[model samples]
Target: MAIGRAKIKSVGAAQSPLLGAAMFTPAVLYILLLVAGPFFLAIFYAFSDARIGNTEMHYVGLENFRSILKSPSFRIAIRNSFIFTICSQIVVIVGANILAIALEKTFRGRGFIRFLILLPWVAPIALGAIGWKWILDSIYSVISWVLVALHFYKPFNAPMWLGEPHLAIASVLLVHSWRLMPFSTVILLAGRTAIPKDIPEAAAVDGAGFWRTQFQIIIPMMRPILSVAVLFGLIFTFTDMTVVYILTAGGPFDSTQTLPSLAFAMGIQGSDLAAGAAISLFLVPLLIIIAYFMLRVAHRAEVN
Candidate 1:
């Protein structure tokens, strides 16, 4: 009897992991169907001849990818995607860090300020971009009027923020960062509060000044959350389309076009489905590398 009881206990313990995995099976299946499945289809289409307005697909065997590689616009889109992602991530991360620190302090109207800070994130991106579109309009821009009123810019004249090449790219980055910084700020704020006050207090007693304590103790402790914020920011900014579509439409001679927008134009608008799939898959390699690094960083931070 004692032997039988021990055998039963061992059997139950051995099944626990299997049961746990079974519990998560639904989520696993959902991701496979909705995310991984579509991605595999896109990868397949990238190598095939799948034109828009056609129900038939023929295997072209790398012709689509070869054509994409030979296209000048593909190169331009790749460059624009990198520039936009890097610039927006820098602006958003820095802005969020400063804002998070400010919000950590107890001050008058702090609650109201926090509410206002998050308004951009709450607002729909399409709506926000459309609003910015008018504000950046060459003829009837209130921002232009305000600048003219300040005598800092010329009156009765404004460069088309969405029409000029450099200005349009800058405008897209500014809008993307503006809409995303609040979420990063909230994440960093959570990280800040998670830190034990005694740690910083002990560092202060060790003759560490404000900046020294922040660098030595605070940032190290906040590393995990910051990594999360940066990873999220990089992915979203890298693939964003709504801001560019509503504001610039890849205009000023397609100088402002990023990969996502280019993909949309090719697949949906231009009816070059195979080429679009190739463009869409172009970033997969970079995204996989980034995700791996982010996981490693997160794991290391947690272990430390």
Candidate 2:
């Protein structure tokens, strides 16, 4: 047995660098061709005066960022993006955690219920957001009709969900939260189920109440899983413009504009490639910082 184990270890240790490189070459090429390639292009464009359909790019240091800083639209985009991400995640994490716990226990129709929960994540974002657009529309909205039928408001006074500033933000936030919850619940559910039944059973024997077991024992163990889910959710909400675009198009009067939407408008619609690239790149530093700390926390949890 010892000799066999030694042979296995030696075989693994004998893996050549060239063989390793050959095995990993595809992934390296893929990243370079897809991810790193576009990123470097964006950086290059950010420092130059470039525009759509213009081959000529003049060297302009910080000019694009300077213009973006001076734009009120950019300022609003920054505020809205942060508010949207933070608010949606706060609601999603708590709601998803509860749903995950509920779904963990066996029950009738559970398989069907889980399928329903997974629908949004499986559905394309554009399709889901477009469906939401119709739902939020003033003329043909099912929600508005339902509320009116319930005597919540007269037809003329029904809330214009996509028209008012605060209402528009809230509406989009709800859509994002709904779309994100399924993924969060699935991940958290996995985390919850990974805990040995013996641990919770022992806690129960120790007279731990439901709340005590959840808060003290279960939550502490689920920290790493929660961190991963939150990080992904944060990045998704922060970078997503499809919901805002389809629902409100950053209206009424750009009140719902997020950084991604704003960048698209400036870069594609407004035809200022440099400014758009600069606006989008603003997220890089912030996302990097967030990913670093979250990963550190995850590593610490893993160690414990």
Candidate 3:
């Protein structure tokens, strides 16, 4: 009986890997179909002379990429994309860390405060951008009206939040930061909570002041999670188009145009699908490179 039971157990154990593969097969197929299919299609479009309003696509070699690279507008879009992503991430990291630290502390109505902070992240980007547009409207801006009421600026002279290049970029950056902050804050808060309680207490016992402990111990130990937060923030901000589309739509003389916005304009609106695909492809390589380095650093931090 014992020998028979042992044989049955061995057979069951032998099937475990197969069972796990079966369970994961559905997800793998789903990703390949939905995620990879579109990606491969985009790659094909980038290399071909695919245009809107026309079904024919011919092999164009590197023509689309070369044209986009040589285009002055494309260059400007690249610059604006970098600026928007970097500035927003800077704001996100600093603001998120501070907010996370504060929120992680026990307090009255902590849940409510967290919910309010998370609203911007949970809300749909398009919907949120529309709300912000109303607040920053050119003609009937609440901010402009409030400023005028406070004697900060004259009527009809309020700053054009989306009409001026500098102001437009700044507004987009602020909006992106607002959207990403809650997510980053939550990530950092989880990092903070994951930390062993004894570390902070020991730091205090060692006469480490608030600044010293935060800078020297807590921050260093949280490197992995911080890198992840920043990585996510970079990816989101770098690839984002919704906020820009609804808020500014790469307005004020293409000054606020990022790669995604420019692609939308040229590919969809201008009917140069190949060029738009090429423009969007510019981000993929850069993103992959960044993610690789960041992940390497994060891995090292974890090992340490």
Candidate 4:
């Protein structure tokens, strides 16, 4: 009986590695098929003259890249992409910090308020953008209607939220900020709660005021969490096209054209696949750098 049990134990141990491999196989296949495959294909398409109707492609080297670089719209798209991403991140981080702090305190209706705040992040992007588009429409805008009713401006001369270039850019920025703020807020809130209650109480005992405690102690402690939030926000905002496409369509003379939107316009909409691919390739290097730093921060946080 003892010898039989020993043999069974050996068989079980031998199956362990095979079992682990079986569990991991699906994830590896998923990444290869969906992530790596598309990435390498994009690189191939970017290098070749791949048009929508073309049955064959020829290697054009850097021609597509050069053509996009010389285009004025491409330059504008790059500029606007940076502007929207940076500005929206700043807004999201600051606003999220504030919201997180406020939500940390117990108050009446706190749960309901959190639900309302999270609605934007939970809802589909297309739906949110479409809602904002109607809200900011020139003639039927609720904001303009309210202003006109209060005699802020003439009915016919109401401010055009999406009609003017600066306004359109601002509108797009607002939508981006709105969509991302709740997600960052949740991240920050989790960070804040993860902190031991003793730290802040000890700071209070030392006569540290709210601002001093927050800026000096709380913020520094939450650095890793903040890095994760900011990096994720940057990637999401940088790569997003649905919001821009639905809200402004990069309109008002292309004042709000972002890299992703321009890529869609040139590649899919314009039928110049190679040019579109080239435009999208610009995003890869920046994203990879951000992802590397994010992983580093996460590792450090885990170690500490």
Candidate 5:
């Protein structure tokens, strides 16, 4: 009896790894079908001359790519997209960090403060942009009215916030950051909370000032979470189009066009499905690079 029981126990232990693998197999297969499958299809469509109206798809080699590279509008859209993405991420990351830190501290009405800050993030981006559009209108902007009242500018002197190139870019960046900051802030706040208070206290007891403790101890400890926040922020900001689409539609003469918006214009709106697919596929390479580096960093972070 004892020998038979031992054999059964050993067999169960041996099957555990296989069972775990089998459990995850469904999720792995789901991801492959849902993500990898569409990705390859998009790549094929991007490279080929696949049109909506045409029944035949002839591979034109690099002509589509060449057109994307040479077209002045495409170049401008790419540049603007980069600018908007970078600027928005900067604002979101910095502002989120500050807000997260502030909210992490015990204070009066901290809960209320957090709720208010999170409202913008919870709101729909398209609706928010539309509301902001009205507020930023050349003739009806409340900001313009305030400026006029304060003698900062006359009734008709308000700058064209969405109708001008530089101003439009700034406006879109501001809108995107405002909408995204709250979400990032919440994420960072969760990260900050995971940090042990003893770490900072120990640093402080060792003759480290508040600033030093924050930089050398607190920030270091929070690196993993911050990395996560940054990664999320980057991915969201990189692919965002709703706010830009509703607010400016790459307006002010396509000054605020990002890759997603440009892709929509070229693919869906312009009925050039192949070009849109190509532009959409452009995001994959960047995502792959980012994912590689982020995973490497995350792994190191875990080991540390």
Candidate 6:
């Protein structure tokens, strides 16, 4: 009986490595097929004279990059991408923190409130953006109707949320913030819950007020979680074209154009695949740097 049990244990140990590899194979294939394949294809297209419906291609070196560099719309798209991403992140972090704090406390209807808050993030982004489009429409806007009823503006003179350049940009930023805030809030709320209950109780006993406890004690403890939230938010906001595409279509003369939207407009819509690929590649370096620093912060927090 002892020898039979020993033989079974040896067989289990021998199969463990194969079991792990079998489980991991799907994820590896997924990345290669879905992620790495497109990445490499984009690189090839960026360097070659590739265009939509082209039957043949030739290596163009830096020609595509040079061509896009001279376009004024490219510069504007780059500027708008940064503005929307940074501004939305700031708004999301602050708003999410407030929401997380409020929801941390037990209250009546908390679950229902949380579900309502999470709706924007959980719903398809295109659907949310389309809804926002109607809400911000120039003539038939619900917001404009409310404003006119409140005498904030005349019936015909209501602000053009998606028409004027500045307002269009603001409208896009608002949509981005609204979509991202709930995700950040859930992350922060989870982080808050992970803190030992005794830590805050001790702070209270030591006469530390709410602000002091939050800023000094709670916030510092959540550095890793905050870093993760900001990293994901940055990537989502930076690469997102749905909100801008659906809301403004980079309209009012491309005031709300972002890099992703510009890439789509140039590559897919305009049929200049090479130029679009090159424009899309511009996002790689900035994202890499952001990811590196954010990951380092997360690692340091883990160590400490």
Q: What lDDT tens digits, residue by residue, belong to model 3 across residues 1-304?
A: 9999999889979997898799999999999999888778889999999988888889989999898989888998999899989989999999999999899889999999999999999998899999999988999899999999999999999999999989998999999999999999999999999999999999999999999999999989998889889888888999998988888888888888999999999999999998888898888988998889787977797797
Off by over 4 Å in 1: 1-29, 297-304
Model 3, residue 233: C-alpha shift (Å): 0.7
In model 3, the runs with Cα more than 4 Å from the true position are 1-22, 293-304
Superposed model 5: Cα runs more than 4 Å off: 1-34, 301-304
TM-score of 2: 0.90
* Structural similarity to truth (TM-score) of each candidate: 0.87, 0.90, 0.89, 0.93, 0.85, 0.91
- lDDT ranking of the models: 4, 6, 2, 3, 1, 5
Model 5: how far residue 3 lies from native, Å = 17
What does the lDDT come to for candidate 5? 0.84
Query: Residue-wise lDDT of candidate 2 within 1-304, one digit each (tens)?
Result: 9999999888867985677789999999999999899788889989999999999999899888898999999999999999999999999999998999899999999999999999999999999999999998888889999999999989878999999999999999999999999999999999999999998999999999999999999988898889889999999999999999999989988899999999999999999988889999998997898889788977887798
Residue 294, candidate 2: C-alpha displacement in angstroms: 4.7
lDDT for each residue of candidate 6 in 1-304, tens digit (9 for 90 to 100): 9999999889879997998799999999999999899889999999999888988999999998898889888999999999999999999999999999999999999999999999999999999999999999989999999999999998799999999999999999999999999999999999999999999999999999999999999999998899889999999999999999999888879778889999999999999898899999999999999889887977887798
Q: Candidate 6, residue 101: CA error in Å?
A: 1.1
- Per-candidate local distance difference test: 0.88, 0.92, 0.91, 0.94, 0.84, 0.94
Q: How does model 6 score by TM-score? A: 0.91
Minimum summed lDDT over a 10-residue window in model 4 is located at 247-256
lDDT (tens digit, per residue) of candidate 1 on 27-146: 999999999998998988888888877999888888888888898878888999999888888998888989988999899999999999999899888898899999899788888898
Model 2: residues >4 Å from true position, as ranges?
A: 1-19, 297-304
What does candidate 5's lDDT look like per residue over 112-212, in tens digits? 99999988878877888999999888889898889999999877998888888888888888888888899889878888888888877888789999789
Error of 5 at 155 (Å): 0.4
Stretches off by above 4 angstroms in model 4 are 1-12, 16-18
Where in model 6 is the C-alpha error above 4 Å?
1-9, 12-22, 297-304
For candidate 1, list the clashing residue pairs, or say none: none
